[model samples]
Target chain A: MDEPPRSAPMSASVPPGGGPGRIDRRAIVDGFPLFVPAVPFGFVVGVAVVESEMPAVVGWSTSLTIFAGASQLATVTLAGVATLWAVAVAALVVNSRHVMYSAALAPTFRHQPTWFRWVAPFFLIDQVFALVALRPDGSPASFRRYYLTLGVFFYLMWLAAVSLGMVVGPAIPTGWRLDVAPAVMFTGMVVISLTRSPAVVAAVVAAAVAFLAAGLPDRLGILVGAGAGVLAGAVAEARLVNDRAITDEQEFTP
Target chain B: MNMSTAFVLTIVIALGTYLLRAVPALLLADRELPVPVQRALRNVGPAVLAALVVVSVASTADGGIEVEVAEVAALVAAGVVAWWRRNLIWSLLAGMAALWVTLVLV
Candidate 1:
């Protein structure tokens, strides 16, 4: 809540199995702000399922099986009107960004145990990635605890939020306008990501492209915007390196 | 949708998503990526988050872009609070507060 726990707590606690490791309290608390957006987003997904006239049990199963909120919304909405393959493709594309998250964390995951590697990817959603991707290097034990704690907490919370939605979604008025909640929460994420110049450039370009390409079908616009932003940020990073080299040259020549 | 159709869709989507997340994570471990690729990957989070924010804010149900002033105000309020306080709770509270106030006033 008050700036992410900057330093990992040094004291290691005994695990239930008698192994010793640090249990990160920050991981538990860090998800508080993220849940703000997740609650409304999950509710909207539940409402979509209800509105589409899908069976309640089937709708709830997607939450358990699919587990990702945005893709769950897409799958639930499309399953009613679109073909099965079409719905599958949409869900795949919508959730494909996790590939990037996986790539970014590969090095960190490399040092982790084989079982951890196999299972940890299940929790690689956007909020989890956003929190862990920027984390300072810490012990593998601590990282595992941090990742799993946050992961499980969010997973349960998501299920609860969606279930609550399924129960009450139909009664909620459309005029309540919970639509903008995710945007507000994501804007907070964007703010946190502005710590670097390349990231700033990337965010600006991605926002512009995504705004313009909002008409693209199957959420391809987000991918396009993300690609363009990454390229722009890479170029910016190269230029920064060049400028720094030039500065060093100038200083040394004097 | 029918129960069978729903189950099939869920299973298909679940497998596809898991592979997308797991394959690269498993295969790319311990591999030293090219410098440029690493640099680009580092920016992926910001790029994706920014894209998500725009799409979520602007995209309508019919896949059209619509900018609501109230929503923009809320985003600005959240961004500012997040920047100033460096805390997510305050930012969320500020943004929600701004949104409700603007919904009434505007």
Candidate 2:
């Protein structure tokens, strides 16, 4: 099948009622490419989940229940070794970054129908959020179709890839180092997602913070580090905006 | 944990994740957030993903500090491609291809 649409068609064929909403072609096509890296990552998760010795039901269930590669792997891996509380905490901390995405997406979701708002977050993974944030225009209108298309597209791809990986099973050796897929995927996403100077600053700060906080329990370091980076980026962004305002005023002096 | 316990933990974690995502989209819907807040939130994507990238590649399968050289090289390759192409599939394919070459040749 053709990949999900990469961008909203400048002109789409939506019928009736302020544009009759079908699943957005742009979103569907665009969303699937982001799934490329996740295919390997899902395979790795599938293998790891199996190795964790959980029953097949529990193992496969996570792919649907969590719908996130990293956090699902973290939770499954932790289950065998850590206490349930520790596992939950690690998973929660891993998922905490979604809070930032959620807040960032709030403006877009605001205009969406109540039912859409209720269900969309279920698909709010890093890839989807990055795609939304990178839009040049950043308009909230018509986001529902884009968001829904991306979500549905990603959900099916992830589910299929992971389930396939599980059936392929542990025959794939660790020496292959397939575990690196998530980092590779995320690295690509990060590079493409960066647009402004503050974004660059934020990435650097976040990496430094994560490195420093490495020993924190339950993988809480990611949460703390992400927070620090955002705060620093905000400061930088604010300063830049202030400086730009001053320059504009000076240029316009009458 | 047993299957039942593991299942329950997964459910709880799922609930926590859903709420984290839902709360903001629900509460902050239909209004312009403060500019500073919006600015901060905009950068959150880069910050969080960067952090995850580091967290993932910095540790080994056994949780050691030593990361594989091939994996690091592959990740760098992927990042460069992503930046240069600005396309997800191309970068990922480039990364995996680089990884294959590195593992085979290096």
What's the residue-level lDDT of B104 in candidate 2?
Answer: 88
Which candidate leads the pack in DockQ? 1
Full-model lDDT, candidate 2: 0.75
| Model 1, global lDDT | 0.80
lDDT of 1 by residue, A17-94 (tens): 212454567886787678767887788888887776457788788877778887888888877788778888888988
TM-scores, all models, native as reference: 0.90, 0.84
True contacts kept of 2: 0.75
Candidate 2 off by > 4 Å: A1-21, A137-141, A246-254, B1-6, B30-32, B61-64, B104-106
Candidate 2 chain A lDDT trough over 10 residues, lowest sum: A245-254
CA lDDT of each prediction against the hidden true structure: 0.80, 0.75
User: Model 1 Cα displacement at A225 (Å)?
Assistant: 0.8
Write down the C-alpha DockQ for each prediction: 0.63, 0.59
lDDT, residue A192, candidate 1: 79
The all-Cα superposition gives candidate 1 an RMSD in Å to the true structure of 4.7
